[model samples]
Target: MIKNYDVIGDIHGHADALHRLLARLDYRERDGAHRHASRSVIFLGDFIDRGPEQVEVLRVVRAMAGAGTARAVMGNHEFNALGWATPDGAGGFLRSHSEKNEKQHAAFLAQIGEGSRGHHEALAWFASLPVWLDLGGLRIVHACWHAASQACLAATCLDSAGRFHGEGLRKAYRSGTPEHLAADVLLKGPEVRLPSGHSFRDKDGHTRHEARLRWWDREATTFRLAALGLEDRRSELLDDPVPAECRYEEAIPVMFGHYWLSGRPQLLSPTASCLDFSVAKGGVLTAYRWSGESVLSNDNLVWVAA
Candidate 1:
């Protein structure tokens, strides 16, 4: 097994930033794939949508994965893309073709036309990706890393390798099912509803009544303290305890993306770090050099500006 890794965050189709970041990490292009002599990349996903160069990003990432220089987990965007394209068997898509859904997915569709060979291939590749990678010491997941959610998925939607197929894939998309809950928890992170009349506008300017919680923070007892990316409006938040199910109590070093975190890259705790730096929003493309460290450190973070 490859012990050295460069765990990368969400690309969001920013191919230039990704290339620069890979270069900064000393990866070199060879034989149609970016490779490292002694290291491999573990991408946290969100490889498409919301930025230019979606096709290029896919080409590079797919080549590296195909060349065995990189591995990846399915991000929410990738999962959504699969759902949007898959037939629901009820005369509708697994994810509806609503205006909001279509708009959110337009960038990808624009670059890789729907029903084209590229689109179909991308969907198949995404479906093949596992939701999480447990590397004994280092765990890689796209969002929240909760044991209960992982266990739930393992028993239902996920196969022995954490991938979805056939009945499992359908169950993951079915609303109100345990498989759906498991998928959401792992792919979209755990969210808790805000207090009545308390809502915050996200980075995308969308108002959200539900807030993603800081599952890695054991001391975050109140909603204000537990919420991620809502520090500016903490005063308006109610002093409510987050649900116990939302906390991550594991000691394993787990890296994730999908938080759209800004500023300098750093560990959330000794065991948790959010690699996503909002590269699609002019933020940096970030990665953490994992050299088999049992605990994460800030010094390992490497990035390139978007």
Candidate 2:
């Protein structure tokens, strides 16, 4: 079990902010003779894409993991960014961002084609990351572990072989058709559904017919926590619970990234916390420390400003 650690939100290539945040958290280079303490820093993924310093973020995290100072879960964006194939391939996360990331995209393509040791090593590292981690009475993931994925989440368990499977999913993502990964899994943030013929409700409870992905509608936003016992081809909107089927029998709080939390670097959900504060967009990259079962203890958290 991970004893005392800091769970950091999505960094998104904000190297400067990340450096500052790490310094504030008391993370330092270990002297060669002295072994570092047992403390760990858990990054909630999204180490690349949508920011200027993807390479820097990758280098730092790789160093930190090697030094045993940190561990990171796989974020969808990282999966997409690292899984880029041919430039002419169908639109994947990498393709979608390539327009804005000319230099990084070119560099990534060259590295992948060269099939050098560094490329292979980086892929191996990404492939080895876990989808979720349980620490300090808290369950951590890139996003929430709703009921539908509970079985997979439980089976994968930690940062072992299970992460390879997530990597496999990434490879599949590169080849599969658009929307193949499903909107709920590929996109960050919660999920909402409007019936084929129905409308989404506003904050004032006014409903309107709008055909958009679940993440686009703010007021009508819902969480897709689990899958119903229906065929995969079935497009019926199911009333699944938000943060569904998380029994919390262990009474452990959960920490996750993937959602921007309205561009604010703060914790949401009194029970399950989301720490992605859009640091790549000039916001803050946040972290929180937890000891016991309670999540509302401000005293238990440590925030490092960007």
lDDT (CA) per prediction:
0.90, 0.57
Q: What tens digits encode model 1's per-residue C-alpha lDDT throughout 26-105?
A: 89999999999999999998999898999999999999999999999999999999999888999998999999899999
CA lDDT of 27 in candidate 2? 70
The digit string of per-residue lDDT tens for model 2 on 1-306 reads 536777788887677787777777777655421123556788888886666666677778888887777888888765655555323344444345555455545545453443567666666777677766655466777865443453443343323444645434544344353333332352243334545674555323546443222222122223322322122423455444333133332245677777555453444445667787667555678888654546545555555455
The total of clashing pairs for model 2 equals 4
Candidate 1, which segments miss by more than 4 Å at Cα?
none
Best by TM-score: 1
Candidate 2 backbone collisions, by pair: 137-252, 148-226, 148-227, 191-222
**Candidate 2 lDDT:** 0.57
Clashing pairs in 1: none
> Candidate 2 versus the native: TM-score?
0.67
